[model samples]
Target: MRIGLIGAGRIGQVHARSLAADPRVGELAVTDLSPAHASAVAGQVGGRALPTVAELLDSAPDAVVVAAPTDTHAELIIQCCARDVPVFCEKPCVTDQDAAQRLVDQVAASGVPVQVGFQRRFDPGYRRGHQDARSGVLGELRRVHLVTADPAPPPAAYVTVSGGIHRDCQIHDFDVLRWVTGREVVEVFATGANRGADHIGAAGDVDEAAALLTLDDGSIVTMQASRYNGAGYDVRMELAGTEATIAVGLDSQVPLRSVEPAPLGHPERVWSSFLDRFAAAYRAEMAAFLTMVERSDPSPCTVDDARRALLIAEAVAASRRARRPVPVGEPSSSPVGLGSS
Candidate 1:
């Protein structure tokens, strides 16, 4: 299958490598804002770089993976949809709900398939948790707890355009909440702090935050997100119900409760970043995307799914700004996108 990749940045490179390695992919057409970077990545993947999105679309690849900046996603998806090209787009879906909804509408009207990148839903541990939730074994589900923290924050430069924490970091958490419980968030209350670094503050973003999400079925979701952690990148969750609680944990790069450490050459527990923690999910999501493209099936992460999550993030941001709980039904008045990395 011929594949076209948009954006040759870090995440784009990751996807490009995955596509290059897949035997089913016959050709890769790559493009980015930085032509050199696009050429470099395409060369490594044994593909050619296209100078523009128009050209990338003209290449007529069977499917396109958009790992570009948040601001670029909606427009790219719209263009892809217009040409009836299948698109697998990275998340935030424009960093705002209304525009995202419009883009989704356009995609639907165009009769093209578009998948949002919410890779965690494809993670083995998270996938199992979602399956268990659907099985209804956890009777009278009461609480859902999610913990996500990066060992280190991104550079200040990135924070400048990160669309803030809610849109960028907690988005995965927000997406997972819906995927696991199959419930709509009704309301949100949020609080945050900037205790980690001065740059985070200067970037007009918080270092850490927690939010309580009220779901449709009276179940509650508590999400904790942070940009800095001393231990390692942490991603964990538990679903507590009247009957029993199901727990899931991502293996930390760091060791746990070990009196005797490795004899030698032990790597630090610190994950380099989200990439290290969720690489397998990335691969799986791409494989799933390929399958969907091949079979003309609906995306695992639909445009509506992307819309709802962004709306929830907007609601949480609104709550934090208003210093009061906000109803998800009430759209966020604020127009600015999320904060730093």
Candidate 2:
């Protein structure tokens, strides 16, 4: 299928590389606000770079991947759906709930397939854990701990306009916890501190935050989010059940020395590269999305799935602001979906 991409940013480049490498996608057409950036990416993939969204739509791509800035997400999705083109949009859908809801409604009314990019759901380790939790191998998941931290801080522009930490970082963990447990988050409480050594709060965003959620089954999930992981991009999760406790850390190559000099050999080490562990999952996710689109099968991650995740994120942010537990409604209470796991 001919696939057009909007945006030439970092994650946009990642999508371009993946699509270019994939066999299912026939052509890659990209557009960026900056002509030079678009030209650079198009050169890498031996594809044409369009100057405008109209020119891109004129190419008649079967699907489009919208990785542009947050504000443009809803509009781009609407435009793609209006043309009956399936869209793969990046997460949070839109920074605003009402607008996001309206766009989601439009997609459903148009009967166009729309998938959101929540890459953690595509992580192999995370998929294994979700399967285990669902198959009773975990024996009733009781608690989950998710840690998402970036290598370092982002620019003031990003911090100011990216819808804060909840939307940018913690939302992934929030969404994944719900998917892994196969339950809805009922309550959310969060707190954060953006102290010295960082100008994060100066841009009206938090550099660090933590959230606690209660699921429908009374299961609990604790999420820690930060944009100040000096080492590298780290995303790890530990799920504890009645029978087994599984821990997966992305950056395991980091050395850990024993305080007491009586450990086996000297110290412990781990593999820390996030991509090394998730590349296969990423490929699988892309393949699955394409396969579903080809066969008209339901996508595992739908537009409503993305919306529900964003709702919980919104609740977490509200909980932090109110310093209390915020209630998160079920799919029935809200116009969202809780698909079969």
Off by over 4 Å in 1: 250-270, 337-341
Candidate 1 residue lDDT tens string, 164-282: 88888898888998998888999999988888778878866788989999999999889999887766777888999888898776354532234576442345555666788789999
Let me know the TM-score candidate 1 reaches against the reference structure.
0.93
Clashing pairs in 1: 163-338, 163-339, 164-338, 164-339, 164-340, 253-269, 254-269
For model 2, name the residue pairs that clash: 251-272, 252-270, 252-271, 252-272, 253-270, 253-271, 253-272
Per lDDT, the best of the predicted structures is: 1
* lDDT against the true structure, each candidate: 0.85, 0.77
lDDT of 2: 0.77
What lDDT does candidate 1 reach at residue 204? 65
- Angstrom error at residue 74, model 1: 1.2
